[model samples]
Target: MIPPPSARPFLDQAGWAGAEILPLAGDASFRRYFRVVEGDRRAILMDAPPPHEDPRPFISVGEWLCESGFAAPAILARDLTQGLVLLEDFGDARVREHLDAAPAEEMAIYTRAVDLLVDLHEQPAQSGLAPYDRAVYQREAALLTEWFAPAAGLAVDASGYTTAWDKVLPIAEQDVAPVVTVLRDYHAENIMLLPDHARSHGLGLLDFQDALAGHPAYDLVSLLQDARRDVSPAVEQAMLAHYQTRAKASPDFEAAYAVLGAQRNAKIIGIFTRLWKRDGKPRYLDFLPRMWGLLERDLAHPALAPVADWFAENVPASARGQLDAGQSAQ
Candidate 1:
């Protein structure tokens, strides 16, 4: 779609002369972005669905991050009435796309990436971002039953799964860690590797409009338990240890890792299923089996034993067969 006439009002209010629009990616939700070239300068044009997406938080987060000396898009102007935002264009080369050819070398690069996550979370968030409380946790965890239960074609023992989830859910709430700004989608796909820098860290940030005050472990899980590609056992282990040590997690590290991994991977399974069935993108279905494997491994850890045995008993045998079919075709 062309740059809507509605955006012109914002440009006029800010005294920007022209707008040139080009197609940009549509990764999730109903949000779409355009690369707008006006005069010799460039900026990103955001098209968000109202009521579904209010630009209030996005604008607030951008301002806060900019002041804190983090890398974020510059919000040149905004049209709150039309849900349009003019932002500085980052670039097209995402870290994941670049790593496809040689993933082994990503170890050093990814370590640097984790440091940035540390930076974002180190501060006690003052931005009025909502804490990811019990309600949100339960709602996200329920996606596994909604998406995976039907795909696996299992009606085995509903009570078993429910009871097990009841056991695991409370543990996630045990540590009421102080809230910090979390980049909810801090992974290779959303990050862009700045290869030209004299002292390159990792990817320059992008798509951080939905920042929230949440647990530190949440972003760590998003990075390590990635849904796109297989982060090797050696690499994943190294990262787990690195983060745990740096965070000064002493005796509880092992148990925490297991519980966190299991919880996150379970969420991914449901998310992939929803992406396939409801969102019309079966491509995400390919990631299901790998996430299943990770969950099973975590289940072996004593921290997750209550839920693991229940899953083994309840999740159908047919699940592996169907999920493997999707991956094989891919």
Candidate 2:
């Protein structure tokens, strides 16, 4: 694949002018990725065009992770004006695809991931990062009412949704746990299994530009309750126990997990719907049922009573079921 014209000068400056550029991937946002290869040398070219995307947060967080001894990709070179960055390549062994091929190794692999989080939570969070405060939580939860509800042909109680979130969000922000860096998109798809590294230090983190100072439970919920792939409930439970024991988390951790799970799932449902309706990406609709299933499970937790009641009253079981892609986005 051809690199964007603007990337040429950046590549020339980074001394990778003649590298072969191959299309890598495009995510939920407007940013695109490309793999750059020059003989034995390799790097990832991130095309985070301005106006819609920024790479500075990604650069800062990644550098912090590297300094802290975590496996976030290293920033090799950057040209912020042209929105091009050369990043250390973590290879193709993403945890989601790896698990799909080697189901038997799922437990061991996930154990390492959980252990990484335990280690991460031990460190004090980076300063100047935004807190995952109540306003953010409420705004996120309202995505269900804003995009998904309308797409699903349900006229939701938007104000009631906000009220329900107001009642429960504080539980997630309680002082029972120390605030740590929450990698807001931590999930199987975004974690790489580095074969060259030792098992304990092998997990490579990606797509963490939106990291925030938040409760430790938030990232765990994101990992175990993934939207793109099915993480068995048995594995999820075992990992939760493992993390709790490993981190010596408070008794309130589970409650925070449920609250954040519901909030994140709600945001994802709205985002996926928006991707379909506004961004012309229908493939995301395929994950709506899985998202609803997880959201419903989270709502079953006693900690989510207020939000659960809101869902029960405003969004029926019928609206939350499997959606036909062609019909749903209409």
Candidate 3:
């Protein structure tokens, strides 16, 4: 990948005049990542660029994660105005990468990840963080109708879905679980496993800038019901049990997990569809089957009765899966 010229000055200003700048895997966001290597030292250069993206939230959240004793990349240098940041490279040992190499270790890795979440939930509130309340959840869930439904060549009115969620969400909130930082994308792809640190801190967090003070179950669901990869039913159940036992959570926690899981899956279905239709990324569509299955399972929870009924009434089973090839929703 070609390094954009706009990033050169920051490389020089940050004292890496002749480093080997190699492109790193980017996510759904507009931000691009590049690894800067000079001899034995290495760092990540985040090119968030222009008006579409901002790195301040990332920097702030990174600091918060680090301060709270979790593993977030250290911001070594930055130019907020230019949306450029140099971060400490935690190396390539991601949990997904490790699991791919040794599937036998999946249980251990996921258990550690779940344990990390339990600890992360205990953190004190951050200043200026927004609440991931019902309105926000409803708005996010609308992505299904706004992008996915049309992309699938079906006319779906998302208002009913949102309306149903309006009724179902209160059951989740009434449980009295303390709201904590919800790292909106806490799935395997964004998590790294650093062997050098202790088990809890070993899990390196990424893509958490969009975090809000929300239900603790949101992130947990994000991990267990990941859209990109198929986490086995056995593994998902074990991790859930592990978390509940460690957290000493009340019986209502499982209900909240199902509710949040349903909301998150609904939001992802729309997001994956939008990514394909608008961004021209079709691979996201491949995960639709797995995501749909997860969504269906989440909907089975009695807590999701209203939203589940909305889906049943609006999105017919025949219209759910992979759509026509190479057709833009627009």
How well does candidate 2 match the true structure in TM-score terms?
Answer: 0.97
The lDDT values for all models are 0.71, 0.88, 0.85
Candidate 2, backbone clash total? 0
Which structure is stronger by lDDT: 1 or 3? 3
Score every model by TM-score.
0.86, 0.97, 0.96
lDDT of 3: 0.85
**Model 1, range 125-244, lDDT digits (tens) per residue?**
846787766666656666788777776666656566657767866565565444668777778787776655323254577766777676677777777777776777887788877876
* lDDT per residue (tens digit) for residues 1-330 in model 3: 567786788889889988989999888879999999999999999988879899999999989888878889999899888888999998888777778889998888898889999998877656779999887988888888888777766776666767788888886788777878988889888888887768455788888889898878888899999888789999999999998888787789898999889888888888888888888888888888888899999999988888888888888887777766568544
Model 1 TM-score relative to the real fold: 0.86
| Predicted structure with the largest lDDT when compared to the true one | 2
- What is the Cα-based lDDT of residue 231 in candidate 1? 73
Candidate 2 C-alpha lDDT tens digits along 189-262: 99999866663368999999999999998899999999898999999999999999988888888888999999
Residue 163's lDDT within candidate 2 is 86
Q: If ranked by TM-score, best first, what sequence of candidates would result?
A: 2, 3, 1
